[model samples]
Every structure is written in C-alpha cells, then in structure tokens.
Target: MRYIYDEQGVTFNYFLLTFIAIFLIPTTYFSLFSTDKDAKLRKPSCNCEACLRKENYLKNRKLSSTDRISKKLAIFVAVGWICFAYLVYKVTTVKIEIDVWDPYEVLGISEGTPLPQIKKHFKELSRKWHPDKAPEDKKAEYESKFIDFTKAYKVLTDEDIRKNYEEWGHPDGKQAYSLGIALPTWLIEAKNSPFVLGVYALAFGIGLPFFVGRWWYSSNAYTKDGIRTHTMDLYFKELRNNSTIKQLLDLLSASVEYKELVEQRPSDTTLLPQIISSVKEELDKRFSEKYQPSKRYIAPYCQKASALFHAHLLRINFSDEDLLKDKYFIAERSIHLINGILDIAIAHRWLQTSLRCMELSQLLVQAMWFQDNSLVQLPYINQDIIKTMKLKKKNIRNIIQLREMNDEERKNVFKALSPTEYESLMRIASIYPLLKIDQAYFKVAGDAIITPGSIVTLIIKLRI
Candidate 1:
C-alpha cells in the first residue's frame, strides 16, 4: 500500500488549526481570570458596627460550598488548554509528504515567463546536462535532470500539455488526489488507538451524561430565583397577604440554607443555646411578648437560624468567633431567600407583602433594624445624636427631609457630627435617588375618558 499527500488539503488543514488556536486563547484566559477575580471579597463601603461585624464574620467564615466546584471547573479549563496546545504542536510539526508537482519549480524559473525565455532556459540547460552530452561517470544523474527539464518545458510551451496543466495542475490530466485530515497521524496509530478510543468513550459516553444529569438534577431542585423547590413550597405555604414583619422574619429563618449550615458544622449545635438566650434577652428589652418568635415545634436548626437573624436585625455584635461566623453566613444567604419570597409575593399580587419583602432586602443591605431611626444610616449618627436633635414631629425622618431643612436648622441639627462626618453624610445623601413628579395623568387611547376594562396608560413626567 502507498500513501500520497495532497498539498492543497494539507494547507487547508494548517489554516483550520491556526484558526482554532486563535479561538482558544481568549476563552482560556477569561475562564481562569474570572474564577480568581470573583473569589476575592470587596471592601465594605461603611465601617459602621454592623458592616465591621459582617466583614469580620466573612473573614472568619468557612469556604463556600461552591468553591470546590469552581476549582474543579477551572482545572478542566486548564486541561483543555493544555490538550489544545499539544494538538497544535503535533499537527504543525508533523512531517507532511505533499506530492505537489509544480512545473515552474521543476524548471527553476518563475511561472508566466515569456515563451522565448522558456525556450532559451531549456536550451541552456540541455547544452550542459542533456543525456547525449553527459560524461560516462555522471550519465545516470544527467539523464534524470534532462528528463525533468524537458517535461516541465513541454507542459508550459505545448498547447495540449499546457491546457492539461492549467485545468488539473499537472501535465497528465486528472491525477489521483489524496485526502488529508487535520488531526495528527500519530493519534490513530495502532499502539495509541485503544487509549484514544477509551478517552472518547469516557468523555462522551460517561462524563457527558454524568455532567448533564447533574445539571438536570440541579435545575429541578431550584426555582428560577435560585431557591430550592422545597423551600419555595414552604414559602408559599407560610406567606400571606397580611403577614406581619416578625412573621416574615420567622419565615426567612426557617429556610433550607440554615439546614445546610448545620449540616456543614455539627458543632454549631453547641452555640445554639447561647444564641437563643442572647436573642431572647434582646427581644424582651425591645418589644412586647407578642412580637417575639414562637417556639412551637420549629426545627432546632431553624430556631438557631431565627436567633441569628434577630441578632442581625437588632444590631447585636457577638463576642464569640464561631457564633459571629454563623451569623455572617446566615445573613449572607438570607438575601436570596428574601428575593425568593419577593418573587412569590409579586406572583400573587400581594402588594403589602411584596413591599415588606423589598423592605427586608433593604434592611439586609443597610444593616439596620425596621424600627431604627433612618438617620442612623449616616456616618457618626447614633441613637445618642438622634436624641439630642429631638427631631420628633418635624417629619424629617428620612434623608430627603433632612436635606430640605433650612441652612440654620441643618447646622443646628448636625452640630454634634464632626466636619468629616457631615461631609460623608452629605456625600451619601447626594447619591440617593430622588424623583420629582412634574405631572401625572391617566389617558385612554381613542377615547376621551378611561372606561371600565379599557387599556389606560398612566403617563408621569418626572425630573431626576
């Protein structure tokens, strides 16, 4: 058996392999870069008690459940890059025996030379090395050289042979052509064939289905909002149009996220009694017995989660390292549960519940309790400062009203804050969104007034 290399086919394979190399570079870079970048925690904007505690907790917290998975994915991406590099080297370096029969190269002259130049070149070559003129010692080499030159010159000058060469790139018309594959030849050699096939079988047959099945299972387990199906079911069962804020907090405490935490560290059970006692003391001081979370038949993990959540809302910092770590984890995961609850609320068109859910989200972000004065969000402004201001009945509870105060009144109210503190307060206030309504009205298209069941468009023009 003989193998012929197709020059055109081999060149095309080179071009394709080059293109694949270019495509892999950015993909490999971004996958590796993002995995590392996203793992870093950003600095908190405020150094308030809550932010500081949260930061400390996070610093001390255990690695997330997804860390191992991320590392595994990064490893796979790296391995793919290594394989691509190896394939590129193999393909580019492989000794390709392309059998291109170029007439111009055979005659040692450029293509498209004039007919006269072609004749002169052949005549010159024949004078020196034609078979008839060869010395006895070099007769065989001379014959081979003269034959190649005569054949190339005939293909360029003779009308019939030139026509054949133009049509088929060879003097003999329509010669056999070999097909080339882009992959390196050694990949399919008998010695390595079984290993290569086994790799294919493992990747496509076993690995593919394993990954796809894992993805399918995960998709079924969670809602579109990233909350588990059973968790969402629990939310649907417990939530109502008139659910109180305390009840909502309790509902959040009962999420499956806490169960996962307990499962990760069984010793968290030891901290449970201490956390429950601290939360109970804070609640007794702040609210009547009616506002407290009920102890009736809740899971012990749920009870611990509820205690941690209440501790966060009450702005109580823990001295215990393990308890604070648990608090941080609970607070971090609560946002997802809150958003999941908000999704259910909006789906049911429960306006009040939806608003409460949004408020809870804001509470988590600002690290303030529902009953705390909004002024406390400002730098250097605590309960003591708020008391001195005696701002009751002024309707200046929010930042907007505080911004609207007369210059004299504003100075008087903020006298207790340092200049730096006041500047920080003003900076934060300036960035807060305030929409001023210029005009608003309802209109029905093709009608003078909005009628029952008509599609009414409410147009409100505002300045930001």
Candidate 2:
C-alpha cells in the first residue's frame, strides 16, 4: 500500500545511477560514432589526381568492427547522459540522515568524564526530568527523555552494555539488518506496480529478445566476411573455370550489398534515365568498350552500379554529385563482396579465377580497372601521357621494366613530363616492390643422399 524511503536509500540510488551513467556514456558514444583514427579526409577543393585518389581511398576505406558506429545510438547516449546529470545533482544536494546513538551526546556530557561526575550529572538529570515530579501535561515528554538518559548512563557505567555499545554500536548489541533497494520509493508503490511490471516486461520480455533475435538472424544471413551467404552463392554459381576480369566486375556489380548503398529516391524515375545516359556517354569517351556492361538482365540499381564501376576503372570523372558519392561508397563496401568472391573461387580450386579476384581487390583499392596500362599507377601519368611516350613500343608494361631502362632511354620516355612531375613519378616508381632471388637449393639434413618420399627442406634467399 505504501513504501518508506530514507536519505540513505535514496542517496545510494542516486550514486548507483551516477555510476551507471559514467560507463554508459562512453560505451554508447563508441558504439554509435567510433571511427578509425588514421582515416584522413582529402581537401575537397584540391582536384589533383593525388587528391582525387586520396578522396577515393577515404570514401572506400573498409571499416573495422570497432570503427562502425550508428548515429541512432548517439541520440540514446545523449538522453542517458542528461538523466545522469540530474542524478548527480540530486546526490550533491541531498542531506543524508544517519541515526547514531552516542552516549555522550544523549547524556549532554563530554566524553571521558569520570564515573563519579557522570553519576552525579545523571542523578541531577533524573531528578529534574523524572515523570513523578513532572506536571501531568509534560509527563510523557519527560518520561521519554528520562528513558534515554538512563540508557546512556547504563552504557557508560555497566560493563556488559558498555562492551556491547563499543562493539556493535548499540547498548543492546547489533541492530536489525535492512536490504535497501537502491531505487526510488514511489517505484514500488501499489499504484505504480503495473507500470513497473510493464517496463520490466517491455525490456526483458520484448526488447531483449528482439535485439538478440535481430543480431542472431543478421549474423546468420552473412558469412564471416560480412557478405551475404546468398550473394556468395550467386558469385559461386556465376564464376566460370576461366572467368575474365570483366566477368569479375559483373559479379561485383551484381552484389545485393549495393542495394543498401545505392538507395532509390522519388526523383529516380526521371533521374535514372539521365544517370544511364551519362554513364553510357562518359564510358564511350574512354576507348575500353570491351569492359562495357553485359546484356543479361540486372536490377536497375545493380546496372547503375555496374556501369559506374566500369566508368571508375576507365577513370571517367562523373559530373553528377550523387553518382560520384554513390560510386565512392559502393567501391568501399565492395571490398567485402570481392573478398567473398575470392573465397568462393579458392574453394572451387579455380587458380586463375582466384588470382583475378586478388588482382581486382588490389585494383579496387588503387581505383584502377583491369586492362588499364600498369603505367597509370605512376604519378602524373595518364592514358594520353602513356600514348605520347610510346611506352608499349619500348615494351615497358610495368615500373620494373621502366626502371631497367638506361638513363638516356628513361629520359627519352619521360621527356614530355615536367622535371618536377618526372621526379614525383620516379619517386613513386622506386617504391614498387622488386623481388630478387639470390640463391635456391634443396637438401635433407644429415643425409648424404635424398631418398624417395623423404621430406626435404628448400632454402631460398631473397631480397625485396
């Protein structure tokens, strides 16, 4: 019917709430907004090739589990912190009342008063406040005071009571133990019982299971790489023994993950035609028509993604803001999808297909498409520059071959590039990995002759 609350229990609840808020604030912040510390933004104003590449890198960067936080959780954390602040204010302002029975205070005498002096004082107090001597109207008040005076006197004079008081903080020994709920008193009242039960039912019965079920279902839908199992199955079914780079692009474009990234808008009905027209028109400017999208029926969104990806490989700069943004995110999220395809290829024991997948993954990171001259990876080099130098005539397929050329030949190849541009290009070229094998041999330890079916160790010394 009713519940009692004391400053002790209420203060404990306030402190408990404050403690919970202290931990939840940071936990919620990290869960909702945490990101990679090393992720840097490129200057939006700088449209240089390097800045463009950096922009793509930032957009397409794969998020680790720790780096992915949703904005919805941020709102929850903010509200929680506000409540916590109020709890903290209550804790600081509340006046706690603790019932401490002090013999000296009750008897109105200083501690360590001699027993004779204490007895004399008690006798004076007893005579003055004794109920027999009090007027009828004041008799009850005097009686209560007298009882407390007698108890304090006994605690100071009697050996056993003094010992109990000293040991257990009470003349009669230990007081009854109480388990404070550390919650507001009104929470447990009869009228509030249904509301409290409903909250408990909503949280544990409904909310908890809902969240756990959602997590379990979502986890099962995707592979360990976070690619959907159904998408992986599609990739496996479509992959052939001799799948080409373009085929791999098609597989990547068709992934269901892009559905979430490339969301449709109310204007897409009219906008889709413009996007398709632009994608086709820009792609034609680049000479690589072989990498054009397949004739097979694909979801409109998937087709847009596929076309954008092909344009990306050809280094086609898009004029549409939404298309560019979508392309960047699609490129980023595609990392997991590509890895999923790689896994499927490896499982099927398709070595060529597996290597192609690996190559595509790397190309995705560099924003280069397959069949582009490897020279495009060098700084300040483009299709026009590569054609002007007649690099193909010199058979310089890679930076390594370019590095192998004599000083005169290298100078002639880069003569068109400015001196500063040439220096930057050379600097990037130098960083390319070049493996050199120094020695190779095989032998069995402590054996004069190698025997059939015997394990042999092959030692190779290599430098990069």
Candidate 3:
C-alpha cells in the first residue's frame, strides 16, 4: 500500500508537468508562427468575428468562479503583452525627438510682415536684449538669448533665408542657415580683403568703360529692337494715365453741376439758365486752374510724362506729319533734357542696374532722334545717305584709336570733329536712314522703300 501511494504521487507529478508543457508549447508556437493572427487575438478590443467568437466563448463557458477569473486574467495578460510590443516598436522605429531651435518662433514674426515693421521690431528688440547691456551676474543667461536673437535677426533680415523659412518651416530653415549664413560672411571677407576686392575693382573699372564704349558705338534710337518696343509701351502707359486724369476731371465737374441742380428750388427755374452759364464758367475756370503750371516749371515734367509719346504714335502708323514738323522743336529740346538726365544717371554709381541701362539707352535714343530729324529735313539726303556718310578708311582708323581712349579723351575727339565730319559720322552711325521715296513714281507723298531682299537686309541690320 505505501509503494502504491509513492507510484501514484510520481504519476500525478508527471501529469502536472506534461499539462504545463502542453500549454506553454502552443502559446510559443502561436506567438512565432501566427504572429499577425495572434496579435489580433491579443488586442483589448476589436470588432472582428474572431474576437467576438472568443468573447462569446468565454462568456458562455460553464466553469467554476475561480476558473472564470483565471481565464479573464490570462486574456488581460496577452493584451498587455501586445500593447507593450507595439509601444516598443513605435518608439524604436519612429523618431520621437525634434530640434528645439526655430528661427521663425524666436523672431515672433511671420510671412508677409511689412519690411518697415520688421526692421523697426528688430531694432527695438536688439536694443533691449543685447548681451553687452546685460549685468555681469546675468551675462551667461543673457548671452545665450543674445545669440538666439542675433541668429533670428540675421535670418529674418535676409530675403533668401526669409523666403526659405516661409516655405518648408524648420527643416528648410536649417539648410538655409547653413548655406546663407556662411555666404554673407564669405562675401564680406571677399569684399574687404584687399587682394580679392582690388582684383574685382580693377576688372570692373576696366570692363565697365569698355562695355559702355561699345554700347555708345552701337547706340541708335531704333537700332535696339527691344528698346523700340519698350519705348512704345511706355508711351501707351502715359497715354492711359492722361486719359484717366481727363476722365476723372470730367466726372468731378459733372457731379458738382448735378449736385447744384438738385439743391436749387423750382422758383429759381427761370434763373436756371443763368445758373447753368455761371456753373459752366466756374467749371472752365476750375479746369484751367487745376491744369495750371505752378512756379515749378512743369513743362519738363510733362515732356518726361509723355517721353515715349512719339514712339507710340509711330507704332500705330499715325500720320502726324504736320504735328511732327511743327512740334519738332519741342522734341529737339527733349533730346537735350534726356541727355542731361543720362549724364546724371551715369554719375550715380548706385543706381538700380536696370534703370541705369534704361537711362543710358534713352540717352542714345535721344541723340539718334536729333540726328534722324536733321537728316530727314535735309534737301539732298536720300536712301544712299548711309553709304555716302560711311567713314573714309583714314577716319575709321582714327575712330578706332578714339575708341581705345577714356571718356574724357573721347569727348575731346568728338568736339574736334568738323561740322561736315560730325554730320557724316552721325548719318553713318544712324541705325535707321531716311529711305528714298520717289513722289513722282509712286504718286504718293511719303512711302517706305520696299525692295524685297534689301528690306530683309535692312530689317536684319537695323532690327526695325
């Protein structure tokens, strides 16, 4: 009986060990082989059929209270493990940290802030938080703040960096910070260093005069194809402005008269005719007063205001021969005015690049206009004028030498030319020559020369 009891105890121990192993082996297999499905099972809450079936099975199970509690606890453990695994994966796989230094946030400004306001705010803040002003005891804390402030200020002030900051936020700002910050420093050093600055200065000093001299050589009002188009555009802009002004004046006058009529009583209807006459007189006076040239000589302004008027008129094929002949003197005076403006523009080293080019080109055009008018009015000049005025070999050689001289030297050479030489040189220099119009053959007073091949050549050469 004692031996039987010992064997039974051994068998019971073996049975318990086998049951534990069986439970653990299936769990391990599911965890490894059916990970996705096992993950679904381990979730705390799910709407899937598997989860619903498992939930129903657990609910309907006929078990002792202790057994039910154990099963529920096991389910809770599995769900907890799944959540822990997911949390670990997400923490490991995804970047959870971000850079703290944001230039835009430091500035306390954003896109589309007016430039004037930005400068004002920057100046205000810079004065308050500058490290130099901070007390020695607080210097370390303030110094970090100052560094951040300075960096923000630098980025905001710059156009390119500000644009990048506006586009991609902090990531792009970092790239811009790396590239843009370094460039300005490098540029400053390059500009300040005697060797580098001197080389550039020398090149520019030499090259600028050379370029302008070439431009002068090639200069003519109609020669530059783009200039003619631009000039025409400017004229149209002025015309539109003038038309707007005229319309506004008319509307104001009309409105005033209408208000007066509305205010007057019916008993004064007999006096309406007299009132109307008076109003007409007042309107005329007002118009004249508004249009008056003040102590300020405004004719110069008007001339400039309508600078490209002639160009536009020409473009539209307007027959303004009478106006051209009568108003030619006004145009001639404008040429001198434009030349003076050009002289001022050339002296201004800091003028905008595009405006500088425009002023210079306008000066050249004005000069050409004077030359063209003079030739057109000449009795003997004809289509052959270009060939006739072409410089003799000796003259060409002299002009070449003059080309190599400085501006002052070239001016002296220009002054030294004889009247006939000046006229001849100008004619040859003209991009557009007066074409021969045979009034007798064509029976038309004015006509453009239209020989097919010559037309093509002229168009190509003159860019007409």
Q: Which portions of model 2 miss their true places by more than 4 Å?
A: 1-6, 9-14, 17-50, 53-89, 104-149, 176-181, 265-292, 437-462
Shift of residue 444 alpha carbon in model 2, Å: 11
Choose the strongest candidate by TM-score: 2
lDDT of 2: 0.77
List TM-scores for all candidates, in order. Answer: 0.70, 0.76, 0.20
Q: What TM-score quantifies how close candidate 2 is to the native fold?
A: 0.76
Please give the lDDT score at residue 376 for candidate 3: 25
Question: How well is each residue in 14-115 modelled by candidate 3, as lDDT tens digits?
Answer: 444455456655665654465453223343243333335435544443234436665775675576556545544543565434356566577688866877
Error of 1 at 270 (Å): 4.3
Q: What lDDT would each prediction earn against the true structure?
A: 0.76, 0.77, 0.42
* Residue 224's lDDT in candidate 1: 76
Question: Model 2, 60-88: lDDT tens per residue?
Answer: 55333224544455666777778777777
> Could you give candidate 1's per-residue lDDT for residues 292-386 as a string of tens digits?
65564288778777777877876776677677767777888888789888888999999999999998888876667787778777666766676
Ranking by lDDT: 2, 1, 3
In each prediction, how many residue pairs overlap at the backbone (N, C-alpha, C within less than 3 A)? Answer: 0, 0, 0
Pick by lDDT: 1 or 3, better one: 1
